[model samples]
Target: MVTGGTGVSGETAETGAGGGEALATLHRVFGYDAFRGEQEAIIEHVVAGGDALVLMPTGGGKSLCYQIPALVRPGTGVVVSPLIALMQDQVDALRALGVRAGFINSTLDFDERRTVEAEFLAGELDLLYLAPERLRVEATLDLLSRGKISLFAIDEAHCVSQWGHDFRPDYLALSLLGERWPDVPRIALTATATRATHEEITHRLNLPDARHFVASFDRPNIQYRIVPKADPRKQLLAFLRDEHAGDAGIVYCLSRNSVERTAEFLNTNGVRAVPYHAGLDGSVRADHQSRFLREEGLVVVATIAFGMGIDKPDVRFVAHLDLPKSIEGYYQETGRAGRDGLPSTAWMAYGLNDVVQQRKLIQSGEGDEAFRRRAGAHLDSMLALCETVRCRRGQLLAYFGQEPPAEGCGNCDTCLSTPETWDGTVAAQKVLSTVVRLQRERGQKFGAVQIVDILLGKRTAKVIQFDHDQLSVFGIGADLTEADWRGVIRQLLAQSLLAVEGEYGTLVLTEASGTVLRREREVPLRKEPKRPTASRSGSSGSGSGRGGKSKAPAVELPAHLVPAFEALRAWRAEQAKEQGVPAYVIFHDATLREIVTQSPATVRDLGTISGVGEKKLATYGEGVLAALHARTPPSGPAPEESPESPENPESPQSPESDWPEPPDEPGPEDWD
Candidate 1:
């Protein structure tokens, strides 16, 4: 247990080499001043030749826990990552910081692979990233054997758990790393994990002695809201236009077709969006991913295949068009937003169909009975989170084994506008009684639509065809609207009082249904909010405070400084294009905001601001100073429009070419 590291200060004992060097490296390379959470301790331990397991939230500076130790230690650090598509960008980001980083992945040609390998052996690289699959090859293992390894950093460590949301079979072989190199220290890190998943990772990776560090799983900057789904595409559009206009985000769908449709709808309605699924050509996916990273305000409509290791720090929102399978998957997906610690949103459109479809999928899935049971348990937890009347954030944290605030987190939809829960016992009985009549009298089972229609006293064709008007339960629920009836059925499904069976998602009664009908169980259900009307006030039924327009700072910028900030962004965009890197790679928006506010006149002065590390200070400092000078506000009234503002025709947001059309059919990877 290496210790002696203080807060953000660089002061430390010589014995704990990482305490001082880690802080120095952070400032010199990444441009941050202090260590966040357990970063200092984790780095110090790894630097002193000890193993560690780190579980921190996204955007919690997980990279530095290993990167700093790698730089401070004697030999190059080898990183085992699961994202082959993102390895290059990861390496590029590191290189932008003036760190010698390389990756050996399928994207590299033979010559390129040999070159990286030579660099590794010659001690010319500080960090080398490899896909977990790469380590399976004999040549790759032989190459590592000849090199002096500083440490092994296993990223996305939750993948080792077979039951984890994003499990990878290749990760199972990672356990061999400890056996092959017993003397070398290792660090395994993941952004999302429950206690069970954490234990599985430890046991799978043979990290019995590794020190465990579990940071709080709460992301206060992200406001979580699950609205009842109406027209999900339109709901998503309203969300984007009202609260997150012109902001970059991700929209997750459960099907490839939905991804395509949503992207097209957003494009036609004036939101720039692109589709990404495994069915698309690999190059197309790569191109789309690159554009998203480089362009501002671009939204990627995708399935789960995207956004595993995305490092974009400025994503303002992550919207789900469908229900995710588990709480772990939901947390991991939503955590992608607000990586920069700026206020962001985790919004979802949940409805009866989502519940029915998810249940159907679980039953029809390829897994055995045990796998289905595990999957069912996962879905149950996610449903509980969606139907929760308490703080959404609190429910999420509790699922991860963290004790949330007793009163509730005030930022989520429930906390912001407390939902009213009514005595739904009667409503539950009504729905259960209707199901019983259908099955017992008619010897028929139908989906939510048929059940809802029958209860609402609607003389639809199916009801009349069955001569169901004679049924005693018919029209008994006429007091409730169709939407209300559907809501009741959805809640019943969530509570396990009702069950979905067969391919068509027919509603059936579970064993618990008997208690509801017997009046022995009291069903309390959240009263669904009325359908939201369109509003431009930046407020809607989802909740208040939509984080405002894109490119806007967390705190409003002074009118006088807005032009300078816009100019800096334009300059940064040009630099990113010229260098083929993300704009944040050059300098984060937070760093640029500070530069504009401070109006640093010289390169040396710019270094004083956070995120202006030594390498960036030397490479882009003069250019940044020049941009600030060019956009100096005139003594008279400010110009009508800055270059990046919406009013400007030449603004990046105005170009349709920035968002390309996705292929008609995406690949058949994993469908909901």
Candidate 2:
């Protein structure tokens, strides 16, 4: 590793792990006074030249792991990204903060690529971001051997694993990053990953010794909703029209064609809509993405390509057209919204075959048999999520190895709907007994659908072939709907009461399930409501807060300050125009509410609100305070003012004029 000559802080250095001096540089350079979650831990490790793999949430601040260290460390940090958009987005944000950041991807021409490479050679860059495909170039690897690169960060590192939904061949080349730069610390970061995926990432990146910093997967800010995929289009329209009206949101579809159709359909309706997917021309895609990011109230109907690196924080909702392949994909997509920590929603629709079709696709794919099997299991888990009557957030978090200890989150559909559950003691016993009887005779060999059919006394071909229909437990339980029965068996497997024997394992009674077979005790089976397929637009399209109409138009300020508020509102509009950003972005309703409540009369007084930091207060305080001081005379009927001036109280020379007039009038009256 090269010892520092000049650092990203614009200062010369000669040390190793730059210590508190580097941290000071970070705070100054990044404008953040403190770190969030395990940022401090991961930063410390990478700063000390140790490898790390951070699994943080969408807004968990993963970029700082490499960013802060890049400025303080001895060499440029090389971030391996999969998308050109991701590199450019981060580069733009960093440059805004006055950091020397640039990226090279397929989007650049040969000349542009050459220019950035020249800067890399001259050590003129702080953070150098690259597509993993770019790193595969012979010249690129050769340059890495020569240049002073201290950190190799693989963003969206989950792509490296076959287990992840967004698997890419280029990402597998990440192992070369560590192999090529053995001494430098390599940190892999992703917003979503299961335990299995974490292992695959570790092995593929060759960072087995890396520290794993796993943040809580909970997006308590995001309200999770799973509407049945009945009339999804109408439901989506109704949802947008009713709840998140005039706000930026996404409607995700499974196919590029679906994306376009959805976007057009939305446009035909009242919403401002645009379509985005890989099939669109690059420029069109870029323009659409740019509009969605930079402007508010533009809805983008898209596939997975639309949201990998979106940093726009105020996305009001994320609606899915078809089901996502796995819960991980779903969470990450929905997690894109509500990153600003204001309330948002994750809404999706799915039908029965949506699950079957995805499962069929995975099984039919030509990959490692093990990989296909894993995909099937993942699909099952996702199906479980779609069919689950429990807290959707809880199920999602649990899938990622986090436990939710609440009776209900109260924010998800299941909690709000309160699915009635009852003693499955007898039902579970019957199901387990059937599994046991079948296993005792043949083995744990069949899928849940097959097994459920056998227990419900359906004399199908497979059951007849195995003589399972003749079993005593057969026909003992058929009261539940296919969906309901499937849910119970799924829960049993999830709770470790049953196990699949094959790749994902079919239902075989586990030791716990065996207890139910022996009539040891009752098992709780949730009796989900007989809900009609909730049309996509059929959801309770309430505001992000509890229920009913949003407290949005808060009883228009105080009557006394209403005119002052109007003046402030006009000033806000003017400022918004000058800045060329949305008025809400410049100052949210929360900030306006503060201004109305405080009615500060001076710049300093306006700056007293917590939201008005020094920089903003300096820039906007005077105008805002001036508006507040420009009071209106109040309202009922307009006040009429007297024409008299309030200055002089005495009538001017009235007596003198009267005497002069009387002398002329007296002479005339005497003649008459």
- Name the 10 consecutive residues with the lowest summed lDDT in model 2: 1-10
Q: Listing every candidate in turn, what is its Cα RMSD in Å to the true structure after a full C-alpha superposition?
A: 6.6, 20.3
Question: How many residue pairs clash per model?
Answer: 3, 6
Native-vs-model 1 lDDT?
0.82
Question: What lDDT tens digits, residue by residue, belong to model 2 across residues 519-538?
Answer: 77677766644545433334
**Top TM-score: which candidate number?**
1
Q: List the residue pairs that clash in candidate 1.
A: 279-666, 279-667, 280-667
TM-score of each: 0.91, 0.69
Report the alpha-carbon TM-score of model 2 versus the true structure. Answer: 0.69
The reply for model 1, stretches above 4 Å from the true place, is 1-18, 547-555, 633-672
- Model 2 regions more than 4 Å off: 1-19, 22-26, 363-365, 422-672
